[model samples]
Target: MQEEFISSKQNAKVKNWRKLKTAKGRKQQGLYMIEGEHLIEEAVRSGVYLEAIILNETYEGAYPTGFSTYRLAAHVFESLAETDSPQGILAILGAQSRFNAAEDFQQLLAKPGDAINRWLLVDGVQDPGNLGTIIRTADAAGYRGVVLGTGTVDLYNDKVLRSTQGSHWHIEVVELPIETAMQTLQGAGIPVLATALHREARDYRTLDYAAGAPLALVVGNEGQGVQAKLIEQANLSVFIPMPGQAESLNVAVATGILLFAL
Candidate 1:
């Protein structure tokens, strides 16, 4: 493997890697960074094209071979790392392709054979851990993809990435307006279900969704639930029954229940 060493935090490459910690910087550079051995392995297994592998000068662990590698000074690696305990390895990868609002929706609607049978739509979910957990759960439940609606946390956030436990590489994730996503799925003959406790909502278990039918479930913000407008637009509304004293479920927990039940 081709390798280089970077000892100065002031190096141009170090400066750029530091920029990847923010959403805006990632967007500007079309790249993001993932730390640790597991994520890097997942990226390789998933066929994600990695830009470069980064290592702390002192890291003793064996790293993947045949990729360009960079060894940084301990201080430099720590400065670039998001976690308190650095794993001594990280990698740069291209950002997932952004959804083309105008063209991609049309293509998705047109391609019946390529349609994902199950999708999770996230709206206004601000917590990184919650969003990541939701994605991981969706992957576990065999969902095909996740759509990140407006007000959702950035998918590339380090906390979010760590929370996913590498499931981020296993499923399709796209960002689009919630309304547009709903309309597109509905247009494609998929039923859109919004999670809410409105009077008209149905018990999620009561719904008779045919086996393998296309479905989209929307889970919203922790405090507000699904947006009223989105709930109104959904083909159906659903709620998990709670007989206990607890008033509600965590968004991630609630999503896992709904995903597996439906």
Candidate 2:
């Protein structure tokens, strides 16, 4: 369960761990890192594929069994940790296997009795915090899954992971073409609701979301609203009726409002 102590920051293993901070490095290694006991535990509880666990030399805490554990020098651990207060516990996990959106959509529909009704389809959401909150909200609202379109922030980014607060382990998050995902879900009798600021958009409050009615909510970029081409594919377009004279809602806040509305 324990390995020889790692003292050098430039040690081969240490260098590999540091590489995870970059998207290119993560891609090349096909691995990502999760920090803190909570996220590490979430990864284990969710049955995520873990490569190993790393701890600081001074860490005297106990950890869950079943994975190889390594201890690094205090400085080495601090250097690898993204946060100021490193919990001295972290896990290296393989990137989640890619899901085929169309196939997953069909599989979910097949289980009509147990099918998840509300789905969040994200399009070009670039902010890691916004994307993370959206994922967490989707889980809390009991949505089935989240389909992230191209240009959405990487789900495994440390900031995004921290923002989710372990919600990523609780729900399905997949990346796929937005238009294709919309079409597949629609073909299965699910309605696609596009959040937009168009004249024809209906007020979100006027809608009633009944149990067992499958639907997908499409949200877009922080600055620009949903892309016009993507919105054109929605079964309906709706917007929050803000009477307070605010220009618009933060994408995450807007997503929370609309997600729970369903």
Candidate 3:
């Protein structure tokens, strides 16, 4: 394994690593940074391809072997960290292959009849926390995967990654257009259900999800809810019936309820 000590914040490698904090940088470089020992351990446990393991000069913890390691000066590590209380350990990894929309979508479609069971389709969920929570919930609920539709926040965003608490490493997540995802699932005989409050919508509890058919649940933006066009394209629309007086549930909370119930 290669090891290096970098004290200069102006080092070319440090500059490149700092770029990973932005969407454009991550896209351009096809790499993203994850700080904290838990995240690094999760990545290692998941057998993710690690480009390098980075440590604050003072970090004393042991990390996995057989990978390149870098030790950064205190100031340099602080400047690269996203969290106020940064964990002394971090990792750099290649972006997951599933982020390629077209290829991953085709692979989902190619699944042998009903092999794709449950999926969470996210549409324009702007909040990183909400999106991350949804993904984590989906993983816990035994869903097949998550398809992030158009306008959804980037899955690699640091807040989203942090909010997931390492669940992202445990499940399959892909990006695709909402319409395309709906059509593909429907074409494969799976029912697509959109969460919305409309005249035609049914109570979520009333739905028959135990019929052994594959299912896909669509949750949308925190404010706008699911897009009108996507809702229309769905096989059905479902809404949670609140007994108490409240406008609506948070997208993440609603998703947990629906995932567990269905």
Q: Residue-wise lDDT of candidate 3 within 145-200, one digit each (tens)?
A: 89998899999999999889888877778888988888878877788999999989
Q: What is the TM-score of each candidate against the true structure?
A: 0.96, 0.94, 0.95
Instruction: Return the lDDT, model 2, position 69.
Output: 82
After superposition, candidate 1 runs with Cα above 4 Å error = 109-116
For residues 115-232, write the lDDT of model 1, one tens digit per residue.
3578899999999999999999999988878889999999999999999988877877878999998988888888899999988999988998776878999999999999999999
Root mean square deviation (Cα) for candidate 2: 1.7
- For candidate 3, the TM-score is 0.95
Q: Rank the candidates by lDDT, best first.
A: 1, 3, 2
Writing each residue's lDDT as its tens digit, candidate 2 over 52-126 gives 989898988877777888888898999999998888988899998767667875776555443366789999999
Candidate that beats the other on lDDT, 2 or 3, i.e. the better one: 3
Question: What is the lDDT for 237 in model 2?
Answer: 97
* Cα error, candidate 1, residue 258 (Å): 0.4
How displaced is residue 5 in candidate 3, in Å? 0.8
Ordering by TM-score:
1, 3, 2
Name the 10 consecutive residues with the lowest summed lDDT in model 2: 108-117
Which candidate's lDDT is highest? 1
TM-score, cand. 1 vs. native: 0.96
